[model samples]
Target: MFRLSSLIGCTVLFLISCGTSKKSFVMPSAENISAVKFLGEYDIPYNLLYKNTVVGGLSGIDYDKKNDCYYFICDDRSDNNPARFYKAKIFITPHGIDSAVFTDTRSLLQPDNTVYPNKKQDRLHVPDPEAIRYSPVLNQLIWSSEGERIVKEKDTILANPAVTSIGLDGSFKHSFELPANLTMHATENGPRQNGVLEGMSFANNYKTLFVNVEEPLYEDGPRADITENNAFIRILKFDVASRKNTAQYAYKLEPVAYPANPANAFKINGIPDILNIGTDKFLVIERSFSTGRAACTIRVFITDLHNATDIKNIASLKGNSSFVPATKKLLLNMDDLGIYIDNVEGVTFGPVLPNGHKTLVFVADNNFEKAEKAQLLLFEITE
Candidate 1:
């Protein structure tokens, strides 16, 4: 069992896995234990009045150590505003986060130097940005979009998901060639609607990049239901120099821990953020939302692909298979922490704490709703 502590306005949940060792699986131990301490929380006003433009839907965040600033990607999709990202300054101290103030904003533009058109402007799907990461190797930002699926006149139109790089000035840099299995198709064996790429990170000294889909591919498995056996998401690692996926593995997601209504069982689970903490190891954020309750359950886990089978060439993971999925250990569960959980969609390593421990920051996607707020939560990690 994990330990829990009550702070001034937040609760801290220290999670640790407990199990005996098996032949194929390694049991978790205190030596592998990591703890997350609640530092502080802040919320940017919804439709925050800034520069005469509304700012909300902060879905992804990345830290720029070079400038000591943070970049937040808004999944606005040109509806409320053009697809854009914001540059902000976050003040931190040994105690916790002091303040986060927006400094400027940049709109993502097409190669033609024009802003992406909204859905209303064009029947075709626009970029539904989800996750963004600052690339130290390229000195730019890499972002992922969960492209939409449209059906018109009995013809299915698939807007393929994309991982694109952009300069700090918001100019397009380059786009990576994704595997064919990731592209959406009209058949039942393709990616489900809005279930394409989401979380992304760079590892191996920024030579290799990793991207994950939100749900199982159409042929890999069925979407998560109320059962304990949830979907298995695909995690792909790309070699920057080669411009191709070098390896891939499967990550099993847990079923919705809490259902807003038992009868309806409207539950959702997906990967929203990922951070490279070590070689072939990552800190992954699994966000589960239960509709009607207006509440979310967010958990952080450390996963390693040490001996996992690479499924990059396999189109389906549902049939009889002998492949091993990545091993994972739970790190933190925000629900047990007693913090108000929202749609947490972003996570990144922040500046080192005064005590030398690394800081972890999470940001929520408010969907630009007036009733919801763009919240930023800070946590300090101890090994």
Candidate 2:
């Protein structure tokens, strides 16, 4: 079954400015700026067996215009099943989403044309995928993995994170050359454990690819907390043809908004998804969760790289520096749209609506938990 909700009281304002620069970013008034209105939501039952495979943990999603189908990537690390992605057909009209039907499932393959083995079967660390996107230039799907970080008795093993490409059939294609600084290191510096790559998107021209980590690197700063201090994450731009990182910028993450629980009072906030709106503009999703709540806080923002400092060579963003983070404008908060919120990790521009407005879609990762259900939320971008 599905649920429908009417959009209401969706007004929000975000003042974006660099603390070190004179430039300021102010979103146009709500009357002028386009609003993403909630449409409907559908759930994929937890532990629903399909073709002998459990259907859950859908973390990332992309729309394939050519096939008129949506590709959802499961965050499963070959624990319950081989790492895989599902092809789903989502029927939509001007009113709302009609139905979301799972069509097929494909297992991700390695360069050797073999499916990824379970962690117990192979001693090597398996990938923890967080984001995926359809690349028009390569005619394939590009995905990002948050590599593992394990500290042992005598040594610290850091598996380098990666952005890889694969065909619709799940055949291995190739991988982008990541910058050395972004790699996991045994030293105290570099990307933190589980804070590696997460959000990914391609530019409108399809010539440049953008990716972002979930949290700050060890050298940058600390993860977000319940204070005024905001953590910093990096966004890297890659040249598609050259497969090299071209530019890097600092992104500031807001602190956790919810109060912590006394028993298990840890809070987490990070960037999970990014979408290209224009040449240098993007829509980024910042999701924050506390230990005790079934609901998390999700916010959408519009940002641009104009006048932002390029820190590709600089080692750290702390101390005295002139680097300016990207300016952001808050678009909408999912909680204000009168719909249930979960772990929203994926966002993409969907097909055009009957009213000629652009459509935006979000998918949640249920973590295969019986208490949660894989959800797909649809919205219309009204300009």
Best lDDT among the predictions, by candidate number: 2
* Candidate 2 lDDT, 176-225, residue by residue in tens: 99998887877768998888898988884667889999899988888888
lDDT (0-100) at residue 344 of candidate 2? 93
RMSD of 1: 14.1
Model 1 scores a C-alpha lDDT of 0.81
- The parts of candidate 1 lying over 4 Å away from their true place are 1-33, 152-155
List TM-score per model, in order: 0.88, 0.89
Q: 66 in model 2: Cα distance from truth in Å? A: 2.6
Residue 341, candidate 1: Cα error in Å is 0.9
lDDT of 1 at 118: 93
lDDT of 2: 0.82
